[model samples]
Target: MIRHCVFIRFRPEVGEAEKAMIFTEIAALKERLPGFLAAHVGANVSPETGMDKGYAEGFIVDFADAKARDTYLDDADHRRTGAKIVAAAEGGVQGVLVYDLEIPD
Candidate 1:
């Protein structure tokens, strides 16, 4: 299995409406894309004690293999959703991240 994780830190000027639209678009990907074992989206619940650049929301997507993952990267729905989400980022920093790995089980 491969895990694709994303972290998003919104620009301070971003309002609730934009955030909601972004989240809704991202959540729709699970049903639109194939090879998705699981997809979860949520805001950071971590207590902001001493963290720098406190990110807002994050998501985890599990795929069966690298091929499936690559397909998702090329998927039309995923691309459209990504474009909307990317537009909401601050300075194009976006706080994006990803990890790919196999799981033995």
Candidate 2:
């Protein structure tokens, strides 16, 4: 199994309403695409005592393996959702970080 995580930082100028819309679109991807074991998207809620770089939203996706992950990346539904995210991204901070790891248990 693989756990694919993405960290997204929205543009500072984005508003709450736009953020909600982005979140909704992201949440809807699993239903529209195949090869997804699980999917979730949310805003960062971590308390900033000292080490917060101000990342805004994030997504988590689980797949059977690298093949599934690659397929998901090119799927029509995913492409559509990703396009929406790119269009809505506000500032220079709107970035994505992805990590894939095998399940350890």
Tell me, what's the RMSD of every candidate?
2.3, 2.6
Candidate 2 RMSD computed on C-alpha atoms after optimal superposition onto the true structure? 2.6
TM-score of each: 0.78, 0.74
Candidate 1, residue 41: lDDT = 79
TM-score of 2: 0.74
lDDT per residue (tens digit) for residues 21-84 in model 2: 7667666766755566887778777787534355567778888777888888887767776776
Residue 19, model 2, lDDT: 69
How many clashes show up per model? 0, 0
lDDT, candidate 1, 1-105, per-residue tens:
888887776677878887777667766776867777887877777787546356667677888888888888998878877776667666554455455667755
Each model's C-alpha lDDT?
0.72, 0.71
Off by over 4 Å in 1: none
Q: What's the distance in Å from true for residue 87, model 2?
A: 3.7
